[model samples]
Target: MKNITPLQVAILVALATAMLVAGSAHALALAQSRVIMLSLITGISVLAMVYYAINYFIYRKIKLIYKTIRSTKTLGGGEEVYSMNEDPIGQVYDEVQQWSKEQTSKKEEADQLEKYRKEFLGNVSHELKTPIFNIQGYIHTLLDGAMEDPETNLNFLKKAARSADRMEALVKDLLTISELESGSVKMDWENFDLQELLQDVFDSVDHKARQRGIQIQVKAGCRAPFMVRADRKKIRQVLVNLLSNSIHYGNDHGLTQVGVYDMDRHFLIEISDNGLGIEAEHLPRLFERFYRVDKGRSRSEGGTGLGLAIVKHMLEVHGHTIHVRSSAGVGSTFGFTLDKANG
Candidate 1:
């Protein structure tokens, strides 16, 4: 049998006593009837006292526990709040479980943030240290003896200048990322021909491409004017970064191409290259600052390592996304969308 509550026990005890008195009265003499009646009355009185006493003591303890739980919540105002259930102990246990889950979730989030913070700090230090060390070495060499040699002196100074330039670029890129992430960078949105913009980007990097013997091309289907709504200067930067990456990583005499597709309400722009394509694993973090497929190659190519990161953030601010597809040895294509201008 299931265990009975205190109230149930009290009711059962009183009923049993009354039934015993009724049964005994039928077998007792007339004189014993009065005694049986007295016994029943006394039993009932004792049962009533026990029921009220138990409730009084137990309810006091429950009330105290309820107050403690409510105090922990610190709810404002003096208005009454309903209990979670009739059993205050069970309700308290449930609330404690809920609180534990929330705390665990918060701790996990905190741990992730801490990990990212450490990685970011380490990356920034490494990037800045490279140029700083290079500049120091060049200056020391010139100081030791190269200063006396006309041929080496100018070369060393140029090397130092280049390292300084890299440092400046790194700092500027960091500031740009901070501003973009902080929502402080204002965008000047306009309706402009995306085809013309791509042409301009190619033109700007044409000298670099030619130096490497890499051919830059616009797909025949995308040669026509494709009007889009976006921040002109920011989008221009995006194109420059993508195109530059393609050129830097492209194989000798390889081709870098751009294609624009007319999707309803948007234009899908893709930049492709027959270059040193990235591996599947690297594609996921391609837009992470300072992340590189080949660190030595990327650093030697004279970039701040923040180009793709900047591209991703700029597009994100415009409520669009960029994606990439590539095979290790074949080629890579990066695609992003732009809102099509109604005009």
Candidate 2:
């Protein structure tokens, strides 16, 4: 009765009043029969009064509950409803609370997605600006008087070409990463000699290493014919990117070492370099696309900053893990584990 709406209360009151009137009329019609009729009329009025009193009390209680639910302090500032009894009201309250929680979770996820989107755009803009600015500056210089100055024109043209190549490489890597992230890059997996695959990367980058006066060495603890199941082309790209980065950042006469070891449950490969090691803060974000520790140095060395990011994604596709260890001025080591060869 306390939970009844205004309409229900009005109906109850009207019915009670009608019953009282009917009782009174009956008493008048039975006036010839004195005592018993009077007694019945009194009893009927008393019962009606009792019913009305009870209904009024229930109505007040329901009004108090409604007020409580509407107040800001109902649950002690908590988002969820707090009630002691397992009544219908409490069940409805619980459902409302669950809905609120789900909405909150969705809102938080949306905020995080928006933050990431902004960050990605900012990084892309920075990456593009570097090469684009360089190309524009060099082209303008070449047009002004560099063309008449053979040495100067040749230098400017060479630098411009390098910048263009970097831009092209960055675009290609971005596309590759997009395909990987969107689950559109299909992997062709087969059993291949891991050592042989690494050798190919060494051969591909060997000339660049020699030109830079850097030594690229590979040491395989495992036998030469050691085999693992992986996507050969994708894995090759990963190794090439890492090796290229090592060479690019290494000192003029620095050492770049590649080691392969079988660790029973997994095959571990480590590529280490005595180069301009990454700072502690930058190490964690090394695999983030377009993240650069030294913007000038990275551009001068023709790095797009997408190499390690692509390496990470390619490894992820093969269900592998990669980790990096570095000191600011010392050197850096990157190691990854591939699934063990099937027995």
Displacement of residue 65 (Cα, Å) in model 1 is 7.3
Tens-place lDDT digits, model 1, residues 26-58: 567546667577668956876787677756776
Q: Each candidate: what lDDT?
A: 0.84, 0.78
How displaced is residue 323 in candidate 1, in Å? 0.6
**TM-score of every candidate relative to the true structure:** 0.81, 0.71
Give the TM-score comparing model 1 with the true structure, all chains together: 0.81
Every model's Cα RMSD, please? 4.5, 8.5
Q: Give the lowest summed-lDDT range of ten residues in model 2.
A: 79-88
Off by over 4 Å in 1: 1-85
Clashes of each: 0, 1
